[model samples]
Target: MVHYDERTPHLHYAFVLVVFDAKKDRYKVSAKQVLTRHDLQTFHDDLDQDLKKVLPFYEKGILNNKTLTFENVAEIKKNNDQFKALKDELANVEENSNDKKAILKITNQELNEVDLAKKQIDSFKQGCLKKHLAKP
Candidate 1:
């Protein structure tokens, strides 16, 4: 997802963006919000123009036939777990901002270690898959 905001012709309000992709059984779906019409056409046009700059490549790369490397798979799992832990931690961090950053830093470091393990496992799977693909 990508976003850019305009400053002129508006000062306080912000144009927003939300995008998501979901895959199921050989079918992929994508959704986008180009404009919300929170203000006049000028503000909305600015958002659309910015989206035009950002959306094409994103749509192509994510929508097209792309192959995931072992690193990519590992990163995905790592990010997922990191986000999950972050979500939980945010609930308890309303009081201690200092400890929150420290804990988050440690959590991210641990996530990297797990990511490395996942990368190794993915590499092993790719090796096995490659062998099978090569067989008659």
Candidate 2:
């Protein structure tokens, strides 16, 4: 879904991106607002280029045959569990406590791990998409 606002001289656009995660068996939908029209084309071009880069890997069957192994799934689940634990600990910490910063840092690290896991799943989804579209 996409919408354009042309109330003023400048134009603003909003669009939704739907990405599938085959490993997790879910869809990750994100809505983005583009303040400048010029950047919209750049965003589309960048997205296309990124998908193109993954095509060769998909063709090689690396991403097609095994999107996520047992180990990968376990690692992702472990990271998610660790992130939840850290978030709970951070919430219990006092605002003025000296340990707050350290806890926050650890929480951020765990969040990054979760993000990486999501990226891996998304890449696998892209590969699946390519394979499906390529089939006659």
Candidate 3:
């Protein structure tokens, strides 16, 4: 998970959203989202509005007896080390890849890094969802 540090004070937790295929007992992360107390008011407002769209389900689940866990509203933070590493890699690529061919290769490497970041975020979101939705 991207954790908070000196650079980002707003990040606080992690979220994980997973979609399971019962027939296969396999799951995939469909989305990764986050919430933070720094924007708690806005977040709650948005959450309330979203819940309104699914009022029936909310009434049946939450209003009856179900409750959402703190896991549902987790925080996000920045990893300075990770950011530095990425920056260093990009700097190295820029320093060495002056030719078009080398630049293209470096660009692909950057793309891979971006994809990895996306997957990491997705995994965190899925984890949060799993915890939030877990039933007693």
Candidate 4:
């Protein structure tokens, strides 16, 4: 889903991990089997290549982040935790601040941070879309 309800819009993709079971003659839900090490390694690169096929203006390597690498699961989780804390703090700022102008400025900055954290988290999550097109 593409979210337009924010300062900077972002996309969210939800999926179920499934793999073919040749012996069983059917597909089975198996995240362990589907999310392989190789898939994690090249997921973003592959996605960028696939996106470029239909999106003329979309640039290759758009998923690459200069400050954060999605490969570090621990780092992503840490940042997510921090993001949550920051959001809670932003809420406090909105409630406590008396100056509307100051509140607006602070809210705008926090919103930008919210957008960045969302992008980072979502980029890490795109690995789940192995061979499926996420429904918008």
Candidate 5:
């Protein structure tokens, strides 16, 4: 839902996080799996990518003030520090995600190689058995 309360039009979106459970072979409402830290972190980026494909004019950014509002300077400083720390954590998470993807690609390649070798071995065994039967 788009709200007019804010300075700019922003989506006040709400939906149940549903994921397909392979074990059950059916879709289930599992917020714990779908609404993950990684999912939340990448939500805006993914949304922006899709939105751009449809709405070319959709600008990517927050629709509100960027300032960290607080009564006291000390409290403002504290909030700023917290925000910085969270940003750092997000960067680290993204970095780790990239590393993991690279690792998975290599692992998949190795598994494919193993599968090919197994198929070749089986074919060779069948050929040898056929040759032996023909000789007899």
Candidate 6:
């Protein structure tokens, strides 16, 4: 049984009751209901009482290995956090790689311009040499 409504803007109470399906090897919701602001307290109290009655059966199922335990929830959370960190790290590395590629492209363009300038200077010097030699 889970109660959640924090993400929504409306002031409503929602409850979900999930049961383990041994045949399907998965958990399924057996019942779910929502209570508006008007009936929130009364419905919630009734739901709590119903859940209390089923609590012993749920516990018995866990003790008999018929139902899953929540011991792996913490591990799942840790793995999710690590996965997010790795995803962020990958994004950073990709961004840095893109920056490096842009820098390299600019550097290549500058080098080409420098080469062209050097060629022009050499051509000018050759023209001057020919002019002076012809006079001699």
- Leading candidate by lDDT: 5
Compare candidates 1 and 2 on TM-score and give the better one: 2
Backbone clash numbers for all candidates listed: 0, 0, 17, 0, 0, 0
TM-score of 3: 0.27
What lDDT would candidate 6 get against the real structure?
0.68
lDDT of each: 0.61, 0.65, 0.63, 0.79, 0.82, 0.68
Q: Candidate 1's residue-wise lDDT over 60-114, tens digit each?
A: 2221224333345679898789889998898667557878888999999999999
lDDT of 4 by residue, 1-136 (tens): 7689965565665789988999999999998987888886777778779889979977634463553666678889999999999999999897777578778899999999999999988886775564356545
Model 2 deviation from native, Cα RMSD in Å: 34.5
What are the RMSDs of all candidates, in order? 27.5, 34.5, 33.3, 29.8, 24.7, 16.7
lDDT of 5 by residue, 26-129 (tens): 99998898676677666766776778788868775542356344556799789889999999999999999999999999999999999999999999999999
lDDT of 1 at 59: 29
**Candidate 3, superposed: residue stretches over 4 Å from native:** 1-98
TM per candidate comes to: 0.27, 0.29, 0.27, 0.43, 0.51, 0.49
lDDT of 1: 0.61
Residues 1-136, candidate 6, lDDT per residue (tens digit)? Answer: 3335544222234558777889999988765333344453355456556766878643222122342333356977887899999999999999999999999999999999999999999999999999999995
TM-score for candidate 6, please give it. 0.49
For candidate 3, give the lDDT.
Answer: 0.63
Arranged by lDDT with the best first, the candidates are 5, 4, 6, 2, 3, 1
Question: In candidate 1, where is summed lDDT lowest over 10 consecutive residues?
Answer: 58-67
Model 6 residue 1 CA deviation in Å: 29
Task: Name the lDDT of candidate 4.
Answer: 0.79
Model 5 residue 12 lDDT score: 60
